[model samples]
Target: MAVLIGLAAALAGPGGTAHAAVPDSPAVTYTNPVAEQRADPHIFKHTDGYYYFTATVPEYDRIVLRRATTIQGLSTAPETTIWTKHAAGVMGAHIWAPEIHFIDGKWYVYFAAGSTSDVWAIRMYVLEGTGANPLTATWTEKGQIRTTWESFSLDATTFVVNGVRYLAWAQRNPSEDNNTSVFIAKLANPWTISGTPAELSRPTLSWETVGYKVNEGPALIQHGGKVFLTYSASATDANYCLGMLTASATADLTNPASWTKSQSPVFRSSAATSQYGPGHNSFTTSEDGRSDILVYHDRGYKDITGDPLNDPNRRTRVQKVYWKADGTPDFGIPVADGVTPKRFSSYNFADRFVRHWEYRARIEANVSPLADSQFRVVTGLAGGGTVSLESANLPGYYLRHKNFEVWLEKNDGTTAFASDASFHQRAGLADAAGVSYESVNYPGRYLRHYDYLLYVQTPGTATDRADATFHAQ
Candidate 1:
């Protein structure tokens, strides 16, 4: 890997500068086990139109890296270990969060781990790769990494500003206890810290103080001339939260006083949405440079039950990154089941809309029906007579809501244009013991009844066919 470290260093340019033709919205693709049995995922979009994702897999026994053309592929794509733990002492074992980055024409991977004999000695380290193709590169184990922590450190991120390179990560100050804090320092190279580490931010905010005295995993992003230092807070349990510290590009980034930490969290666990402990996120820009996405992992349940290690949740998740009017993140609530956002897709473009196909919809209704009127189209889609659009497996269920839409798909291979129209208003979403509606099993949104998601009143992409249903590879 040392021979090709130059290939990883090339990441200093943000993946070749030529972006893919991404839409105004970046698509959020997910891989449930994003390299299953892994934790603390760190991803990088390479200049090769594919994303390279790596995580800490205690069971894998090696540093694993996976690449895919699309975001969703990362979960299922075949993975290769660019490097593995060697002897004891320097670059021994217990590898975690091995992130490959390109800077100054070299390929370098940043990770945390303990020596073969000392598990608590986990610290940041780098591997020098010497090839353009990361998998083929010869990875040489580098020496011990210097970070903000004089003692323990991990989750290191590096970025360049004003022709100068900076490194940020979670650490434990010598004066402080073992609790990790976010800090920044000047970098001499991918493996060297040039200057003393400065305190950038801490888990001081309410959300930051959610679990134990936590705060670590800093991913630095400079967008719209604003330096956003995003980090994870709390334990890996339900208390986990995502926090941000923002400042102008001209400000002293190495100084802690220059940044202002947001009191509220930018992202957090949504028990209702079945996404909990959403943190340790990295930002990815779409091919068109318009879409920004935050990718992380979460659990379906909130509480840490009998065993923390055996929990089945903690699956990787992907979502669009939104900005508020105040120039900050506006990650509204997670899209609960059966609800989708309509504004961005439908209203943004007149004819462009979301559609679903080859899906099953079934619902059962009573004489004293759930609602006075049956379910009907709300906006874009409309059936003049014996529905020209082919639909299968719909039973006696009324899909009506005061404010809702549907995304109908035809039996034919192609999808139909988006349609929306109000349905008979009555008690619908209010009841959680929902009717026996045939819908896909989605954590956030569902195909309630024969309910097709329409254009108007839709909330987010959760209502889009991509979110409600799945596609075959």
Candidate 2:
């Protein structure tokens, strides 16, 4: 299951508009989920400015890792087989999605495996890295981790909160209702349990109880003074979805009741999207600190006619995650491949793309009554785009396309030569030698002006000016 091509990026112009536009961006969204060829995909950001993606490949008893300089790069990056199962026992059989975690002073890789007698006898194992650099160093098998006293346990994650370390995982609890459930406990070490586990919740919701009432693949995230626990729900089919638990940062995290579960699944396949079994997700931030991406695996079709176990369309996919007004995570509705994204700006002036600047427009408007420095013409944009202005002290926003001289027109139809203050001219068109106007930016270039990115500001003292110029750093 490969993802259909729909590429996008976020950029800023030297002129500081909140967002830079990317070309071929679909202004609207339509959901079209993907097929699954990968299972339980995990993403990690490495120190070398690359992201490494790993997932379960049931056919091959080996740990395969893919790396790329960018999140988009990982999807098409060259994959490397870092480790493989060699025997039929303890650490050699049924090697599942192995996750690499760098902690304390070493690298620890965790996974689930078992002996030849039974694949269901899956337990957790860890491998340690001994050299200074993991990519070029050797990883020594540190052996199976001592987990809970249960025979069934996998999909484990280690996280720290409020200075205390903890581990969460899914397991088969005979003492509980259906035997399969989710739980968490404090870790004695990287592999040992320190205290009694708490039953977070049962697979009762419609999303979680989709097939045989299974809940697994728990991942943790922290944001906006709250900690979020996200889990995979249902069987590995179209019925698969994502369920979440949220708790405030000040709450007693050890208590399962302190966490509140979402009434519905956070992520699931809709009819618009032909893909199914969309679960087992991880979250990572972008290099620019402006994006939070959702990493998950999807299957292209709906019905698993034959055997679901042998189905091979589970491939990995990723998309940007948005946030709600309250600062909580909002996994925006997923869209189909090839859907155009909103244009984004990439005006990083340090790279010398263009000189752009933004500021309040100092208006001497006699045609209409307006305050001084109440208008702005954010310039240095290349093609067709939009420019906005507002009363800094008032709560209103104004927007118009850049192709026309909206700012200049609104400011009593005047264009002043920026290079010289000697002449004040009338504005008729933007492309004229002394006449300047904003235009939409192409995909590759960003609006750049000034020593820093420009944005509109409020009216100031009578002498304050609403103009900016670009200067090389």
Candidate 3:
């Protein structure tokens, strides 16, 4: 985690270069565990210009909600308990994973609950909210959403594709040995399933069957001509992770054959970041609606005492979701705890990003510990309306140019060091859409990667301009 040296150091611009505004870029800084003790997190950015948040509380006794205009505001947003579980019958115990959605101008919450008598007999249920503000809206209880079977079921999420609504969830098949499988069905309405559900994915891969053969928490996002369904797998401990299923947007979604499951988990626990059991994710767009954000929950520690379900340490977190050249989402890894950092992606080599390896700065793709590539774009250390790049995981260290070569070095609090560390933010030399960094001391020299190594070089050709230009994301 980077340490703040002064007020100016903390006063960085939000997620873009100072010269030009980039629409829909991520916020400059947001602390992790956006909401504490909140698991199975879900975030819904509605047309009302607010981000609605819901999750399984540690108590697991009621459905609660909160809203904020921005993702950062959600951390301190006051929560309102809109509904509670029944005493003993249906929707009575283990109230969990409540996801609020707006369907056909009405607000609906899809959640899972168990009977008090049979605490493990969980089933999916719904609640309807009457108005624009779900926090203050009149919520009416709508009974359980009947699936094909009455056995163990949970984590129900809904989405619409080509004007047709579909509900996807996890349910146990009595005939199968696996704990649960992901299923999808057409939704006649927000609270009712119209036809038989198709089993899209099950836990068969080694990573999926880590502690238990489980597949649950189905969340969908349609992008790059494909419908991507992501779900949690394995037991809810250090082994818990996320798996994905991909299908063509035009395919018959109800048919299992349409979806192709990834052989490995798409996202998983990152020991380097100290985030364990990272799964059960929801997606929301940035305030500008340009960047996609990954919202999920994980514990800061790896071990749990007794049952993982009883542990209350799981906390809600959010990070920007990157994309691959192939147009698929690149989750990267769970970042280190601190102000959420940004990765400077090369405009020319979209796959490569600014990273530090062995204290030397360079641009590389798929760097390990990901924190090595993440940097806090803070206000200038030299105080000249410039910016300084601070290492995300290395406190007090920054990217400083020495002998024209950029290296990760600890702050020495000297004028020369500060001047060497600061850079004048400039609009991209090659592409106006991105940004280029000019050295504060050397007026014409700009930061660029040569042979994958970072250096301050004066641009003389188109290739140098392309190499100097980067998108801060």
TM-score of each: 0.68, 0.66, 0.85
Q: Per-residue lDDT tens digits of candidate 1, residues 304-399?
A: 877554564555555556554355665544433221222112111112222332222221111111111112222222332211222111211222
Model 3 error, position 98 (Å):
0.2
- Tens digits of per-residue lDDT for model 3, 1-473: 11112224232333321222342453345678798899999999998899999999999999999999999899999999999989878888999999999988889999999998898999999999998799999999888899888899999999998888999999998889999999999998899999888888888899889778999999988887888999999999989999999899999999999988888888888775688889999999888887888999988999899999999989999988766656677676676666678988766565568999999999887766566888888888999799999887675789999999999999999999999999999998977878899999999999998888899999887667777888887
Lowest-scoring 10 consecutive residues by lDDT in candidate 3?
Answer: 1-10
User: What tens digits encode model 2's per-residue C-alpha lDDT throughout 1-473?
Assistant: 11111222233222322221221211122122222366778878767677767788857488777777776666567677767886666656777767766677776677888667777777878777765445555878777666556467778777888877787888888766663677888877776777788878678877788666877888888877899988888888888888899998788777888999998888887555354677788777665545666778877678887767678677777766544446567664343443212211221211121111132222121211111122222321221233333221121222222322122222222232121111112121211211212223222111212222232222131111112112110
lDDT of 3 at 68: 96
Report lDDT (CA) for all predictions: 0.56, 0.55, 0.86
Which of 2 and 3 is ahead in TM-score?
3
> Of models 1 and 3, which has the larger TM-score?
3
Report the number of the highest-TM-score candidate: 3
Better-scoring candidate (TM-score), 1 or 2: 1
Q: Total clashing residue pairs per candidate? A: 68, 47, 0
